[model samples]
Target: MQHRPTIRFHGAAGTVTGSCFAIETAGGLILVDCGMFQGSKTEKELNYRPFPFDPESVVAVVLTHAHIDHAGLLPKLARFGYRGPIYATGGTMDLCSVMLPDSAHIQEYEVEQLNRRNRRRSRVQVEPIYDATDAALVLTQFRPVRLRQWQEIAQDVRVRFWNAGHLLGSASIEMEIGQGRDLLRLLFSGDIGSGFKLLQHDPEAPAGFDYVVCESTYGGTDRLDTTDIGRRRILAQEVSTASRHRDGALIIPSFAVERTQELLADLIFLMETGDIPSCPIIIDSPLAIRATDIFEKHRDDLENGDLLVRAIRSKNVRFTQTVEQSKAVDFVRGFHIVIAASGMCEAGRIRHRLKNWLWREEGTVLLVGFQAAGTLGRILQDGAATVRIQGDEISVRANIRSIDVYSGHADGAELSSWLAGRLPVRYAVFLVHGEEEAMEAMARRAAALVGDEHVYRPRLDSAFRLDADGPVDISQAGPPPRIDPQQAGHRDWNNDYQTLLLDLQAELRNAADDKARGVVIRKIRRALEE
Candidate 1:
């Protein structure tokens, strides 16, 4: 008898970052969304570790989207000698063309900064996970696949794409594996988008399948909205009011891709219709500006597409691609709006912009998307009075407000509604890509629809055996770095660096007032001198 088809949860089993899963069968090996681990500094170290499996052995790959957490590791995977073809939509490939290189630049830049500090402390220097050249190598492997078209990727496995409505070229992958007697259907919902998107359609519901893998981001509850159309009306009012009264800048920390373009559209529409006065709008993110070019190239592909195309071309909008240009904006800026990236506030020009604008009462920090836990964005959203940046504590006096209307992920209701159409799911339903609470809550809600026995939330690196009947847990070694950190669904890290990191993280988390701490240190030094 043939061995049972097995699936391994390599990444994204517990956390929202590092989305990777592998499936093995008699035909061969297949992988989906080899993404990088993200979030706190401790969590990101997982990206430096070797892949759980041999990259060269994988026959083919299907990328779900171009977001860093979903497709960021492709460059790293390729760097390790994986020469296989990567399957993605044209838009995904195009976005990755810019995004992967940008991620590589960050990796290189961060490593340089880290080493400079480490050198001062006489600590060992570390290498970046991947560089821009490595990212370029991965780009050569992407093969574009059109939406809704079925293409066989392996001996007995065929795959098709359906728009996920999360990001450009995002999709829900439907797969069929095996011959007449052993045929099995599986679906991977990469990231599901909700209604009220500015330019994209609603997420496509899953079709009938034996097994389904779904994302549970925003699983249990909903992000409260601040405006009707992605908070554009509110944004207009805030910008117009600030432009007229305060004469200070308005800063929007946005995701460089869809969020930036959507805001441009809404702002243009509002200003053109006399809803608000048109102040100079400066796009300070280099990545966002390149992505805008890609958006214009694909204008026909979006809803109200040409309108934004025209809006971006207008004289009031400025794309700052060089540091000189970005810096130049500050000199002439009076009541202008600066949109920057790293939506979660982990990195990017947004940090610099935030540092300069956050202290001014006249300026406002308008958060336009989800801010992950433990990130600077979340700290600001939680009303932090002060935050340390680049070794300096910065005051946070600028008004911080978030509007959830720009989110790309579906909420609890939308997830349930998406599943409502796929009633009577024939086999196991696995939930990944969410926090522990979210996954568990979604499990509870899904149990009411599907039998409790059929719903499974696999932990990171957990193994499962699948056949015609259903899926069952299998005993196997967990994925590499299977447990670590304070976040839910933690995998382990065995390196000494991790041990040292844990200690440092504890100190940071438990640190006291800076001035008082310095005084205490001086007192100890004086006592030692005596």
Candidate 2:
């Protein structure tokens, strides 16, 4: 019997986060990006469950970038007994050194809080997926690989990194497996960046592959084409409008890596050139502050490197590295700007800031990145009258503003163009990392480019057999899917429950009288009883 190679869609299939994939060959199994799930509580619960695959069997782990969704679960992989070499670019390795540890700290801290409440309620305690110590240990296994150079990771398996332009160290992984007549050429596009990104160059990759696993993050939406000056102008207007309220603060929920750095450079430039009024710009998250330092170290490699260096050195910018210092921002008077982490407002200091200022009409929440479905950021972006944050229902009175100019992911048109660039995908193009609608939209575009038969939309935990000709869907031949495909990217029961509670509160308040309110309550009680 001949050895057959297979590719498994372990994560980032029907959803946008938790990007893990397995490539199994005769030599061994190689895993790409063991990441953590974010967003709805149901989706997040998947993080605590055991990995569907055996970590110990993985011979190598290839990382694309250090974003929490793509690389967050690495420590958990380490905890599960995988000690293989993790390959990434030098920049990715450096960023992960700080990011992975921070993710671990967050898990430990959040778990501790949950356990404290559980103890009080006489409920069973839970452990974090991985701790800081595990995060630290995983760092030792990192093996940095330079871009555009092919390196052998396993027997008869070689990979080359291409600049993805998504983050500081992001890259697309191209692999050459087997030898001679049995050779397989595959490409995994790890979060391609929008060509219009302010701080990075356009995404780059080679063409001609047997199989291409691509991201469909911004598949259905197309942003207006804007030049660098135009992007800055939009930001300036937003800042200028918000700053007019001298008594309020502007809260920017930003991703700590590239997004924060890009905003800082643009904000400082606007201030120095008088495009916008100068104000105190506070970096509230310690992770953002530390990541900023790393960005500074590699400023020379970034576009507009001088602007970034200037922004970091600017006196108007302040970095709060301690808890006390972060808390002190609350007392600061006047119109100031704060950039905090956990960009989707899922966790981190941004939530605290939002809780404090969300109810103030004068305050403004400027969202500059992608907000995944079921996250607090998405809920606010969708315009909720009230949002629950850490058990407190806070009224949404702040000016909620969002701009697409700063998004890291390329929009639908760009993604289509990217797929076209990698033309003649002989076997198949597996679309992942997008919601159902976005994926469907991209599937149409992909079909036009590579024939409808060559486009595949894989579900979570689905697997495909790869051979000399093409891919065969062997999903049914394997174990059952880890999750229901229908629930992959949609808001789960937790979101529904929260929405119901809020709706009930509004109904009671708007009732004609106590009698009407009692009728509403009784109706709900009757439904519950049934």
Return the TM-score for each candidate structure: 0.90, 0.98
- Point out where model 2 deviates above 4 Å: none
Over the stretch 1-530, how does candidate 1's per-residue lDDT look in tens digits?
Answer: 17677898878877788899899977688998999876655567678878878988889999889998889999988999899889999989999999999999988997899899999999999999999999999999999999989988888888999898888788989888887867888889899987767677777855687888988987887656633453676777677666754468888998899889988888878888888887788899999999999988888788778888988988889899988988886676467888998888878888888888787787788887766655678778888767766655677888887766777888877887777666668987899888888888888778887879989988777788896688877745444344542443333332233334444444455568777656656765798799
RMSD of each: 4.5, 1.2
Stretches of model 1 off by over 4 angstroms after superposition: 223-230, 240-245, 475-481, 485-530
Model 2, 409-447: lDDT tens per residue? 988999999999998799899999999889999999899
Model 1 reaches what TM-score against the true structure?
0.90
Best by TM-score: 2
The TM-score of candidate 2 is 0.98
**Best-performing candidate as measured by lDDT:** 2
